[model samples]
Target: MESAAAQVGCLRRTSLSVSDVEGRHREMIVGDRSTWSFRVHYHSGDEIVHMLAGRAMLRIGQSARRVEAGETVVVPAGVVHRFEALDQLGWGFVSEFVAPGAEGPGPAKTESSLIAGVRAMLEDRYSLRTDVAQIADACAMSKGYLSRRFRQESGISLHDFHMLIALHNAKSMLKGGSSIVEAALDAGFYDQAHLTREFVRTYGFTPGVFRAAWQSAPRLPSLTHH
Candidate 1:
């Protein structure tokens, strides 16, 4: 990789790749960008990118490496990185992603006390009818500050995390033969309709469909909570 920003050009393209494993697939990303810069971010899987043209400033952790045509870079899962295209010719890259393992740890415990306390509270009691404002008040922090800090440190908004907890519990109850309405109430939702909406939005299907499908399939592995 080379770092010559002035010479970089914007590029746009697409690519496709197939996975070797049956029923598994990998997406191919081929693009040329003369003017492109991405914020620092991370992926859940490992990625290998082959530079086809021009150059790019690839930041992995705190180091920036210049990659020119014919070179390749491998980024491991969970490592933060960013890309800056260099040259008017832009740079073309083809990437392949590798899936990472399941059952990773939860958010680090070294964040602020407010964040840790909120996390613990949610883990222990998300099934109760509690909202963000109440949680913030209990933690002696403003609602706005709590929301911002939670997202910045945990990579998920406070509301979404609560929904996730609810959904996890609901799924467990469903597997135990609880009715949708009963599971929804026990999981802190207002009613069956509320549960159906979030369930469909998140899982792309309704709870009834899921239960029927699950009955025909092998039991899923136990869910690991943080």
Candidate 2:
């Protein structure tokens, strides 16, 4: 697969990039302890975000959504939206972009079982096997079919979804003062560079930068409310 930068460039050239932000992308921004707010003006491409931590309100078009830890939402392209982190809960979001292509339309609503299973794997690291084929089998589907369905249901390929989960876990470890190499191993990545590559792709910053930002920020109350 092409690097995230290359993919972003492709989306930009195709006029599929979000206006303020250029290109199809995935990212996580660790907000400060205080509430952080910004208007999201997206021109093209769709977005699916899974909130891993904190509480936030998402304004999509004229509708407002309250999102808490473990909640997910979809923002269609061209919709004016904004997100604000409420209270002390520092937010972690996993986002993916969908460009126009053979992929067809945006992500379809996925079955609760599938979403629950995927979320479980992400949270309970022990339950997840690193092997793609094994995961597909566990889902009771062929690899190719699982990939297609995952893309259709999640607006991202199965591999990208798994990588995002791994990245999220790696970030948590790194923020907790783990070394990059150790974080990579704990997150199921092969090596530091491999984690770095995915980290940059998802967050537009290196893991070191992300870790520093997270560590220096004031601590938020734990997200025990769910």
Candidate 3:
């Protein structure tokens, strides 16, 4: 993993797209005065935007709100929202637009070492099955103990976290032009209908509609880290 300073430096030079943290979900690190001005006219999935640094302004329909560091806002599916930088703000932002569930606070600092190990496992191998027993083993704790502690720290069950990861992957594939059936299989969904049902329920529109809107939009220039 890159050092925080290195990550910041990369952002300062240009906008960078990090590896997806979950399925179609991506985290964008935008540097000072790097402005993003585009309207998200249609939404296929809910988006949870967390401000990791500086400040940002979010416009939803007619109303606008400023979000500062350490704050977060959930943009529900189908809402017309746009984001703009506030001043020469550098921001580390996480955008999860594939899942319908909510995330509580992340794991505590005390569990950083363990969380790192788990993250490594997930990043290194997409085939690794995530279960309470497996995660507990990675943390070197009993299943029951890990379950309770993880819930206390993250405010959600371990299973739910894995589900979020799966959903995120599915969304990314969809956005990349993969068929619904293919994305569903790739994301571990039972079938295309299962994926479609959950996706529509969380995002307020069918997958077909979302895909059409996304494909019709103007493509922004590719952003990369130096």
Candidate 4:
């Protein structure tokens, strides 16, 4: 068999780098904590996250845990997960694998028509103060029922979903040269302090720092490897 050895994406980060290993989607990953995002995402296959250095607060589905250096977490296919590094630089590697002949991981199990409609509505009006009671009424359901079902399907509370959207908008405005205060108000935060608090909790960093990083770094280090 021909050797499959090949160097993939560049490591524009700290002196460390991820070596490509066959089978795993990525052999390793080493980057600043800012590289991690708060957005909950999933894979089409089993993902193995191995921490080589530092630590992070990891959320898998409704469960949250701390993953430290030398520890590992296995995320089953189609499960929602996200990570927030405990410190400025956390070194880790993530591997993805899908069994042969199995169906590809596509959508979350909870993506019903109702959930899709709800997602659309939130995406459209995320800046407004959400009234779940009204949303429930519109859907002809009780507040508690809608809340529980939405959580079950999205792996996030409805309020959090709104907040995430708001933060996303704020981050974009910041990238586009909006002042911190402007970004906060535009994204529906009560004030800069309000946006700052939520930004820290969600991104493990403050809004000012995020904007600075974006301003200072114009481009990702071209994905290179040894």
The lDDT per prediction is 0.60, 0.55, 0.53, 0.61
lDDT of 4 by residue, 1-226 (tens): 1112211111233222222333321222334333454556544445677776777888876778988878878866445678876776654544333331224223345457766667567767736588899889888999999999988877878888678767767866875678889999888888887887787566444676656545553332232111
Model 2 residue 144 CA deviation (Å) reads 2.7
Instruction: Name the candidate that leads on TM-score.
Output: 4
* Pairs of residues at least 3 apart in sequence or in different chains that clash in candidate 4: 9-223, 10-223, 10-224
Provide the global lDDT of candidate 4 against the true structure. 0.61
What does candidate 3's lDDT look like per residue over 147-219, in tens digits? 7775554444556555555555676676667787887778877777776666544433345544444445334
Clashing pairs in 2: none
Query: Which segments of model 2 are wrong by more than 4 Å?
Result: 1-111, 122-130, 220-226
| Model 1 deviation from the true structure expressed as Cα RMSD, one decimal place | 12.0
Clashes of 1: 20
51 Cα displacement, candidate 4 (Å): 2.1
Name the lDDT value of residue 178 in candidate 2.
Answer: 88
The TM-score between candidate 4 and the true structure equals: 0.57
Tens digit per residue, CA lDDT, model 2, 1-226: 2356744542332211111123322223332233445424332345677777778888653567788878888776534456777766456566555343434222223334675475455555632254658667788888788767655544445555566567656765765778888888888887777877666554445676655545554443331000
TM-score of each: 0.46, 0.47, 0.48, 0.57
Give per-residue CA lDDT, model 1, range 114-190, as digits (tens). Answer: 65677578867736555788888897889898888777665556766667667767865775668888888888888
Worst 10 residues of 1 by lDDT: 1-10
Q: Which ten residues in a row have the lowest lDDT in candidate 4?
A: 1-10
